[model samples]
Target: MDGLQAYGAGKAGGAFDPVTFFQQPHAILRIINWLFSVVIFGCIANEGYINRPTEEQEYCIFNQNANACNYAVFMGCVCFLCCSGLLALDVRFPQISGVKDRKKAVLADLGVSAFWAFMWFVGFCFLANQWQASKPEDNPLKEGGDAARAAITFSFFSIFSWGAQSFLAFQRYKLGADTAIFGDYADPGQEADQGPYSAFPGETVESPPAGGVDGTAGSPVGYQRQEY
Candidate 1:
C-alpha cells in the first residue's frame, strides 16, 4: 500500500495530489525551506560577484563580511538538498512500521532538525552582524548592497523555517516517548511477547485446582511439589 494508506495519513484517495501535498504542515515547511534556500543562495552568490570592485582588491576583500555571507550560501545549498531528500522520503515512505526503528528515526530526525535550526540561526546572525560591523572606506555604488540585504532577510526567514521543523520533530519525539512508556510499541521483526500490559479486550489467568496429587492442599496434580 502507499504511504497514505500505510500510515493512515488521511481519508482521501491514496493517490498523490498537489493541493493535498502543500496542505500538510511538514510539506508546507519543506517547500518553504526549499524556497528560502534557493532565494538565500541566489542572493549570496550574486552578492559575492556583484559587489566585487574593479580596483586592486576583490569583492570579498572590499567587504570582509561577504565571506561569512558566502558561507551562509553554502549552508543554504546544503539545507536545500537535505530538505529535498527529506521531502522525497516523506512522500515515498511516509510511515515506518517497526516501533524501535520508528523511534530511532524520530530521534535522528530530532537531532538533524535541531542541528539545522541552530545552524540557520547562527548563520543568519553571523552574516548580519558581520555585514553591519564592516565599514569599507571605498563607497562603491553597486557593491551588491541590495543582494546582501536580501540574503540577510531571507536568512532570517530560514531560521524560523528550520526552527519550525525542529519543533515538529520534537513533538514527534515526545509522542514516541509517550508511546514507549504506556503503549504496545513493538518491532515486528522481533519476537513478540506479552508486554507490561495485558492483551486488548482483557485476558484471563487460569487457576490450578485446589487438590494435590499427594492429598495435600494448594498443590496441583501436574507433578510432585519441589521441597526446596
Candidate 2:
C-alpha cells in the first residue's frame, strides 16, 4: 500500500529522485538485463565469427559465416537499446505512477516482455544448435567457441529474466485495474476518484432542520400529526 501511494504521488508531479527510483525491484532487474545484453552483444560481435566454406581453401580467407551469431547479436542490441530507453523513461516520464497511465504502461510492458522472452529463447536454441552442428571431425578446434558459448548461455538466462519481468508487469496491471474500479490501494474514507458515490468539488450538502416537521421546537421523537 505504501508503495502504491508513493507511486501515485510520483505520478502526480512529485520530484523524481534517483535514489528512490533505483530502490524499485523493476529498476534493478532492468539494469541487469541491459548490462547482460551488452555483454552478449560484445561477445557475439567481436568473437563469434568463423570462416565461410569455399571451394578453394585460401591461406587468408576474407569470407565468414556468422548466421547464428548474427541473430544473437541483433537480439542483444535490440534488447540493450530497449532496456536503456525504458530506464530513461522511468526516470524522466514514469507514466506508471498514475492509475490510467499505469494500465497503458503495463500493457505495453507485457507485450515487450513477452516478445523479448520469446526472442531470447529462440536465440539461445539456434545458437546452440548451430554450434553443435558445425562440429569438426579430427582434432576439432572452433574459433570464438568460448564467446559463442557465453552468448548462448546468457541468452538462455535472459529467458527467465524477461519472464519474471512480465510477471511483475502483469501484477501491476491487475493493481491498476483494481484501483480503477474498487479503489483498492486508496485511503480508507476517500475512494481515490473511483466508484459512483464520489464527493464532488464545491457541492454543498444541507443538514436537516433543528425543528420537527410540524415546526414544533421540542417535538418528541417519531411524533405524528393528525389531519382532519
Candidate 3:
C-alpha cells in the first residue's frame, strides 16, 4: 500500500536515494538561484546602461533600488515560481494535477536548462573571438568584465539545472519501466520510527541539538515566550 512502491515513490520506487535520483536539493537550489537572478538581474536591466565607471552603481540590486518596481517585481516573480514548484512537488495542489500541467513543468525545466547552456555557449564565443590588440582598439566588446560575470552565472545555472534534469531522466530510464519513482523515501536508520514528526502521545521526547545526532530536534526559530 506504500506509494512510490511501484506506481508511487516507495519501496517499489526506482532508487533508495531520492536526493541523488530526484535531485531535490538542486531543484530547490534552482529556486534560490532564480531569486538572485530576479532581484539582481532585473534591477540592473531597469537602470539601463549608465555611463561606464559609475555603471557599477547601476549594478547594485538592493537599497535605493529596492522599490516595488524593476528588480522587486522580478524577485517576486521568481518567488512565486519557486513556491509554485514546491507546492507541486509537495503535492499541495493535487487537486489541480493534470497531464498538461505536468508536461508544462517538464518543458519549463528543459527550457531553463537550455537557456543556461546557451549562455555558456555565448561566453565561450566571447573568449574565442577575442581580438588581437595591435592598436588599443582591439577587443571591442570591452565585454571582458561582462563576459566574466556571464560565464560565472552561466556556469552555476548550467551545471545545476542540467545536472538535475539529467538525474531525473536517468532515474526514469533506470526505474521507469516496471520501476518506481520516489520523490521521497525513508530509511529506518535515518528517519524517525514514530512517523511524520512523530512524537508518541503522553511521552516527553528529548530535544535534539542544532548540529547534533540526526539533527531532528530544536525549537522553531524566532522569539519564544517563556513561562512565568
Error of 1 at 127 (Å): 1.2
- C-alpha TM-score for every candidate: 0.70, 0.70, 0.35
Q: Per-residue lDDT of 1-228 in model 2, one digit per residue for the tens?
A: 223542223444567788988988778879888988998999877866544354333211111344666677788999999998777766654534455555566677778988999989998778777766664531134556677678878889899988887787777677666656555544655443344444565443333357866678766445786799
Candidate with top lDDT is 2
**How accurate locally is residue 89 in candidate 1, as Cα lDDT from 0 to 100?**
59
The ten-residue window of minimal lDDT in model 1 covers: 1-10
User: What does candidate 2 score on TM?
Assistant: 0.70
lDDT by residue (162-198, candidate 1, tens digit) is 8888788777767656655545555553323433444
lDDT of each: 0.67, 0.68, 0.40
Error of 2 at 30 (Å): 0.5
Ranking by TM-score: 1, 2, 3
By lDDT, the candidates rank as: 2, 1, 3
Residue pairs that clash (backbone atoms under 3 angstroms), model 1:
none
